[model samples]
Target: MDLNLRKAIKSNVSGNSADQLEATIVDAIQSGEEKMLPGLGVLFELYWQNASEADKDEVLNALEQAVK
Candidate 1:
């Protein structure tokens, strides 16, 4: 069984608008299920790839603060 999780996740949210994406993210986080992590990760990867350096730094700072 070959599962390309990133591809799958991307396909699932491909056409979503910003509000729709936010809803999806919020729903997944509220669910608190381990299975949702990969999808979140793929979403983060997409964001990271498109983010500017300043934006990336902001995200990293937020994540660092979140874990502190």
Candidate 2:
């Protein structure tokens, strides 16, 4: 995890519109830098915390497919 969580914090993402959030996510992935991982982890943690069990299972299934 080499992400700069502070930069995202500065962007005040809690108020982000859908497009802004999407752009942030896209930029992080496209950068392909190892340091962006912590930011992604934070995003994933947020999702995991809020997701239902079915959603978690679905995500795990897809992840399983990709990692194979």
* Residue 29 CA displacement from its true place in model 2, Å: 0.7
What would the per-residue lDDT of candidate 2 be over residues 1-68, giving only the tens digit for each residue?
78667566645668778898789899999999988777777778878999999999999999999999
Clashing pairs in 1: none
Which parts of model 2 are misplaced by more than 4 Å? 1-11
Model 1: how far residue 26 lies from native, Å: 0.3
Model 1: per-residue lDDT, tens digit, 1-68? Answer: 99888899999999999999999999999999999999999999999999999999999999999999
How many residue-pair clashes does candidate 2 contain?
2
Worst 10 residues of 1 by lDDT: 3-12
TM-score of each: 0.94, 0.78
Q: lDDT at 27 for candidate 2?
A: 94
